[model samples]
Target: MTFQPAGATTIAAKTPASETARRNQPLQSFDLLVGPLSFSQATRRGLAFYLLSDGIAVWLATTGLVAQAFVLLGLSRLLAVAFGRLAAGRRSARRGLVAARRPWLEALLYLFTLAVVAAANGTGSFAASLSGFPASQALRVSAATAIDAAVGYLTVQGDGFFRVVTRGLLSLLKGLEAILTLTPWPVLFAVIGFAAWKRGGPMLLAVVWAALGYLGLFGYWAEALQTSALVLASLCVCLVIGIPVGILLAKSPVSRAIASPVLDLMQTMPSFVYLLPAVAFFSIGKPPALIATVIFALPPLVRLTCLGIEQVPLHVREAMQAHGATPLQTLLKAELPLALPSIRTGINQTIMMCLSMVVVAALIGGGGLGYNVLFALQNVQYGEGILAGLGIVFCAVLFDRLAGSGRKGGA
Candidate 1:
């Protein structure tokens, strides 16, 4: 059963002829199809130019350059419909001349009505603009004066609302300042050693304490506190609206559908767009900044709250239902407890978003670390800007870590 291989001469003799025949076959076929191929090429070239010109025309129309084309088309269609209707009405009345002439008269009437409507709309817009301009100016001046007066009053009294509220904060800082200033390095090391024993080990404790010492050396302690306060206030406002909206959306499908588009717009629109409206309404200062931050930061909380409630297990809901639990009771007991972790994460995200926005908000006169950072940027003081930016970052990290830890522990 042994098979013999072909010799090289025999194999070469047969190969080239077949190869030449196959190559020639394609040329023969091309000769037959050339007329059709030429026709296709011409057709394709024409189509490409046609499509390209059409695309350009469409773009021009969309951008308003060819707006008159659309206007003419609309008018033509309207006239055709009006004429048809008039003809029908006249035929029914057995009046040919009136039917033929009525369409033109109707079209003129429509044109007049359109003009009237447009005039009214234009007048309304003009009046609104005029009214809003004065109010906007008044609000801006009032907001600026109020903020300046408040700051000046606090500065003069040294015992105003801010001072009273920040007393505990000042005390905490003073204690830390005393400890870092007066305590021996060895005593600090000993405290670190104690923390290491309680928490993990000496290495972890050393890293933590070193970070604290570095922050102090960089003089970021006070800036950090101020940033924290700003973020806290922003998050509080975000939650006040976000959570309720979320709950409402979760309970009502109609609400969810209605709100989803608005949320999408809010979340997708540029953060800078928010600034103009905020300035228009609230004017520049912490309040406007607060409003912007809330708008920017609140979407996640609402979205997450709706998500968390929806994700609750059906069985758990059914169990509550079987036990004759009312909707509110079921939500309070079963749903909220399970949804807390998600809500907390949303809150954490809200805080982070607020922290990031505060810097942008500074452009519109937000104070605290935001103002400091903006001042540094404007004055070309890199050191000050970097320090203030880092202060904001530290506060964000601290809040995120603390909130995350609470979420984990609570769960």
Candidate 2:
């Protein structure tokens, strides 16, 4: 009988596929096994279980266990060397084995490590005296002399060049001062309106206004303005120095590697520690405070710039190359635009760091809300301290939100 097309199709569907047959017959098993271990195996298992139970606790108890472990290992080597010399009846040879190959290098390394450990442990004074020795003092003095001489030259020259430069700087400051005074309230409102109009809407705007109101209500308007000025100055200085350093580091792997640890140290160094050197060099004043803030706040910008530039996609770089772009053109057009968001984040972080340092800087004669806060604390005026602290919080939140929103808007 010849099957019709429909009947043939039904037959094909009804047939069991090889795949389905295999799926149905998948069950397989080997013989069940029980184990007995040799002494070494049992010991290994026991040790593993012991470690699993107590490893973290042990580590926590011996906080610097890794460093301690290295020291112990080195001691063991020294002992072996001593034993070898004694066995050979050449006791003097032991000294040769244990002695540093390059005595000066070893001494320098030891001093560096000691300084680092001391700094980390918060013995900053000890580290400073040891690490920042006579050479540092001499360099600092020379720099100060050079700066003074340059200032003198500028003041005395009174040539068109000096006059133009001085006038330009004065004009800039006047413009900034005017902007600060006149624009803040309007800018505040405008920012609120923008935020409300955008993603966060009215709720965020209200919060922003409420914060500004609190600053005003506490009679901190002038202080807040001063704080803002300092923040702007510090941020500008950070960018001016940081961007070039970041570019250089990004361009050279050797520089990047060398700079990485230095940046880490600069960043991790305590805010208070910054005050000591600042005081020693620049003494107690607004200038010293500004310098310290710049030093502390600048690292993140530099790091982020390097990171952002480095992270630009290879294909994007290649595309720039394919277009016959010069290095300068590629950097200006391609790299900078792509890296901007990350750089913005860095700037935001820098502003935040500056805010944090305001109080510390005040300890070294910086004025602003920080000075008031310190004064309140010293006088034990709870209300004053609280009010000043709140003012700082308000300023920080305002700047942070504005910067963050600006970044988002850019993106």
Candidate 3:
């Protein structure tokens, strides 16, 4: 053992008491406040600001100098900024501002700005004067004219092209309807069951069984089939258009830059907006309704498809290239397969959107359960409306379940 030097004192290690003392020391530095009263630095500054601003307001109003309130407000804000920087610097030099402490100087400035404005002239009155400044109507008219001219130019000039495309879409829609409506019920049921079994296994097959039985037994077989046909036709068109565009967007940043805004507009636009343009281009009927539904439902698939492809593992892609796989093979064998779940989710959302548009579409001569619901509404038959509404719900749930099955398989 070593001997200690004479006159040396030993230092003790920190105990729990010392730690508690340290914590309490910091607490002593704060000026605590409860309820309406506060003695903290921020509170004191805020109180000073409140009194000063009010004094200024009272002087300005009493002296008939209220017109200078705006200038006073600006000066007060500049002063507050200066005070904030000073306080921040002081705090940084000290123990530093703790998490619980707040910037009261900034709060004081905001409070003064609002109070000064309200006391000098009412906020609403100030806003009204701005609104009545004679420029609002001109702006509105200019915006409306621009929108109208753009719409009219496209509609008038592109009529021939739209007409040709509309005819082709109409033919395809009609053919799909005929196929679904004209097919024997047993055959259709079998096909659906087989598809369900192949994609989703026995449990999904049972669900399909129950769904088909519900429709068939309720004398809704024909109308249900027609709705299905409409949904399928729209789904087909959406996939055809959306997938290619999605691929292009995924591969090219330039394409994505151009298309993303358009997709955002399409997705956010009101469902009714889709129908108006369709009605203008094609008369109110299944063709127009189908076109409207297509517009309403197509964006999600494209967006999700692009998302899915982009989300594919970069390492996997690199591995494919390392193996000398062609771009087509890499996409088909790796990316698309992995992206199937997201794409399926997109399809699911698209189907639901199409189903939701049915009632709206029915308003324009698109027939099915929507027509029945409308009829019930007109006649005030609550039971009939409820029944038809259930029919639509059933259709939505059935398709949703089928689509959901693919997600599990994809995973």
Candidate 4:
């Protein structure tokens, strides 16, 4: 054993109670007093912006500066949302933090929507001036004249071309309708039932029968057939156009750049707006209605087709190329096969959208159960409208079952 010098020793000395208590005590830096919590940073900012914008808009409008409030709110809203969106990049990607659309655009939309709601709320004259956005009459007239002139030019100059188109579409539609309407009801029912049974099992078979029974019992079989034919015709046209366009979009960025905005306009524009061009080009008839329905239903198919092809695995494409596969061969054998499920989804959405256009189609002289609803609405026959509307719903279900029901992998 080694000895220590002076006061240092091997054995520990006993300490007084106070010294012992203080021996291993820790110094305090901070204390915790949990009680309540406020909104998170992002939440706080978003709420503040929403409140400030509404508050400031109300104050300004109340002060009788309507247009000024609109202009200033535009700026204040920008400020409120300046730090609202989290930084989105490769490193910062999180479940819901990243915006699918541009932040500024979304913020602007939010402001507009907020203003609209505030103005529209019952008796909320508090925000009454936000919705007044009248375009100049001269500008509106000029635009209308330009549109009319273009339509006249097309109608006059392209009459032969449009006639050919109309004839072709009409023939296809008529042929399908004739088949649906002229076929023996029993045969059609058996075929539909068998197909439904084979594809979707007993439950789907039952649903299909119920829907068909509704159509038959309600004396809507012929009209329902007409509606079905229209839907089928539109589907055929969409497939022919949408698949090729989708393939092109997947292969070429230029085509995508050109087509995407057009697709957006097609989708976002009111369904009624489609009737205008259809009427201008094809005139008011079944052909115009079909064209409008096709245009409205086409975008989803094209978009999904492009998405599916683009989503094909890089290595799968590489393998096909390595195997000396031509572009067409690779697309047919690999990409299309792999993308089948997505394409099927697109088709499903297209079918539903087509059905939705029934009433719209009726407005343009397309005949079907939609005509019944239109007729009822004209005369205020609530029972007829409700029954006809149900017929359309049943038709939608039937078409969806027949066209969209399949294996998940598109088998």
Candidate 5:
């Protein structure tokens, strides 16, 4: 029943749904090119080289036999490449051009790995060769011994210096602890409540008081004070060292590049790893605990400070210079002011991280809520451990909230 003009072409009675969608989105319509890709010149050459490498590797692995197999395999692989290259040249459209791909490289790795293991294990009648040995323990032992020797040497030579540093740290710890523990409880509560109210309003004030009340009611006030002292001491050390290092890194790309890997290592290294060197240098007690906490918590502040400084707007720096400001003045006024939020964030993160280490540091004679937790854990006292852990949590949050308070009263 259909009618058509004399020169008209026949049309499909029904268009497919896919075709209909493509018609609707004509600008976006395209075929997804899943690839068995057409070879480029580099790809052609790389394949040939890869085949040659494989042949050589196999020949070497076969132990003086099967060297001729390589020639046959190499010739066959090269011939395939040659035919592919010719077919590629005849093509007018590059239908299979694709993004970077090195599946062949991965294949090569697997082949080589298998070849190596076989050679090391001995191929049929071939004695195991001296090359490609992944199963050896002698090297590891020697390295461990060398490290131990170095640590021992350092321990012997640096005893006096370590002792002096330990004394200084212990004095600082005791001083802070004395002040915290000796202060009248009401005065301390008033100070905390007032600061909380001022910074975070009445809600924060209530939370702060509740946390403190838990510690006092459960007879954990003294331990809480000890934990705070540790955190505050560690915070001071972190700020003293971290800020300048951060500023230096921000200003100098070379220093930043060098320090970046070290910072990454510090942040990623297990907190327990620092404990050995700390214990060796400072011995067990508050000093070693402080050292461990400082190492554990130092990275965030440094990172944040550098990020803040780097994030300061370029125009602001230029404006400062335009006003005839010196480098110091520009940094002090323009950069630091603008970077304060980030810097404050860094400080708060450092405080929290510092608090977390308290429990771990307890393994090295760090007494406080952490000690209580550890003691309770050792005896399998669930109730005591949970209560002590809550005490630590309250201390952590209390400090974190205070640390996060805004300077301009809107935090």
Candidate 6:
């Protein structure tokens, strides 16, 4: 618990027990095996006895003699307890209880586990059969029917707010597609290349140019542009939603506890699973595709942004506070700057996720290189599918490089 000067770096010191162990080396190579487990003189014998017994119990269990296994386990546990008590002779009840409890607890656990295994094998049931008149399919159908009825009721009754939002998002996606597809290829290339150069230097700029050039040269110019626009739009949507939520999560432990499982669900569910809800709400098109992409790719940025902010070196924030910096000032100047590299990494992963969903996104009405790839798959055009896939790879590489540069620069 030694403290250093505020500006000085801290190094960890070895514990006294470890230093003692190092100084008092074991007498033989075999003794070295017991060194780690022997934290105290009395416990060493107890541990060794318990391990030997436990091994025998496990071996007996593996031989299909369940009753014998339990007997062995109990016998070994009793022996360990006896040894421990012998070593701790004439101790108080409290101390004796503390010393003896470990073996009893371990024995009970092993006994219970063996009993369950024996029961399972004897009954010929792994999970055991359930006897009931329950109607699972009926329950599922009823739930689905109720939900569909409710949604239909809402739709019929004119849900202005929901309808308005859906329409607006759809219009926005359409407008973005038109702009990207209508823009001259050379102009788009120059704009992207310039951005790459400004953020990533000359090497990245060349990569960006080559990737874009290949897309155009291979006759995937329009599809590439469309996919780029869709991916960019989805990324923007993810950031707009994810960052604020991430900041909230970082600042509030309660929010983090609530969000952890939701993020897990978002990340764990298949990408296509999102499309079902999107289609239900938006009714299938570019808008639904965009929404699904955002959902699929958003968790990483939110989780990483939260983690980055939380890991902003407590001392640095404290120093900022000591200098009369407000909370927002400390966060923006001290925390966010240090967290920039991690946030950039989050953004990189989000972009890649969005790109990966391109072909899946095309399954609905969302058109792009995904649509081209899907068309090839349907028509059995191997060359077309391969070219489209290569186009996607090129775009992914260019974006990945740009993200790498941003991350390094932040670092």
Best by lDDT: 4
Per-model CA lDDT versus the true structure:
0.63, 0.67, 0.76, 0.79, 0.77, 0.75
Question: Could you arrange the candidates by lDDT from highest to lowest?
Answer: 4, 5, 3, 6, 2, 1
Residue 369, candidate 4: Cα error in Å is 0.7
TM-score (C-alpha) between model 6 and the true structure:
0.68
TM-scores of all predicted structures? 0.51, 0.58, 0.72, 0.72, 0.71, 0.68
How many clashes (backbone N, Cα, C below 3 Å) per candidate?
0, 0, 0, 0, 0, 0
What are the per-residue Cα lDDT tens digits for candidate 3 across 1-411?
Answer: 966555333332344655433333321111211211644334443455455555665676676645666466556555655666566557745753232224465546655665555554545665556444456888899998998788788888988988887788778878988888788989988988887777777877787788888888887877887788789888999999998888889999999999989999998999888887787777677888889899989999999999999999999999999999999999999999999988989999999999998888898888988898889999999998898888888899778877765532321
What overall lDDT, based on C-alpha atoms, would model 1 receive against the true structure? 0.63
Give the Cα error of residue 388 in candidate 1, in Å. Answer: 2.4
Q: Candidate 4 — which residues are off by over 4 angstroms? A: 1-135, 406-411
Looking at candidate 2, the ten consecutive residues that score lowest on lDDT are: 26-35
Model 1 residue 352 distance off true place after TM-score fit, in angstroms:
0.8
How do the residues 323-410 of candidate 5 rate in per-residue lDDT, one tens digit apiece?
A: 9999999999989888888889889999999988988999999899999999999999999999999999999879977888544333
Return the lDDT, model 6, position 127.
32
What is the C-alpha lDDT profile of model 6 across 1-411, one tens digit per residue?
954544332222444765544433322212222323545543543455456546756776787755566564554445444554444444424343222223344344445555554554454444363223446898899999998898787666656765786787777777787898888877888888878888777767777899988998989888887898889889888989998899899999999999999999999999988898777767878888998999999999999999999999889988998999999999888888898888988999999999999999999988989999999999999999999999999989878886665422321
The list of candidate 6 runs beyond 4 A from truth reads 1-135, 146-158, 198-202, 406-411
Ranking by TM-score: 3, 4, 5, 6, 2, 1
lDDT of 2 at 296: 91
lDDT of 4 at 98: 24
Give the better candidate number (1 or 3) by TM-score.
3
List residue ranges in candidate 5 displaced over 4 A: 1-135, 406-411
Q: lDDT of model 2 at residue 392?
A: 96
Worst 10 residues of 6 by lDDT: 26-35
Which tens-of-lDDT digit does each residue in 147-249 have in candidate 4?
8998899899999999999999999999999888889999999999988888888778888899999999999999999999999999999999999999999
What's the true lDDT of residue 232 in model 5?
A: 94
**Candidate 5 global lDDT:** 0.77
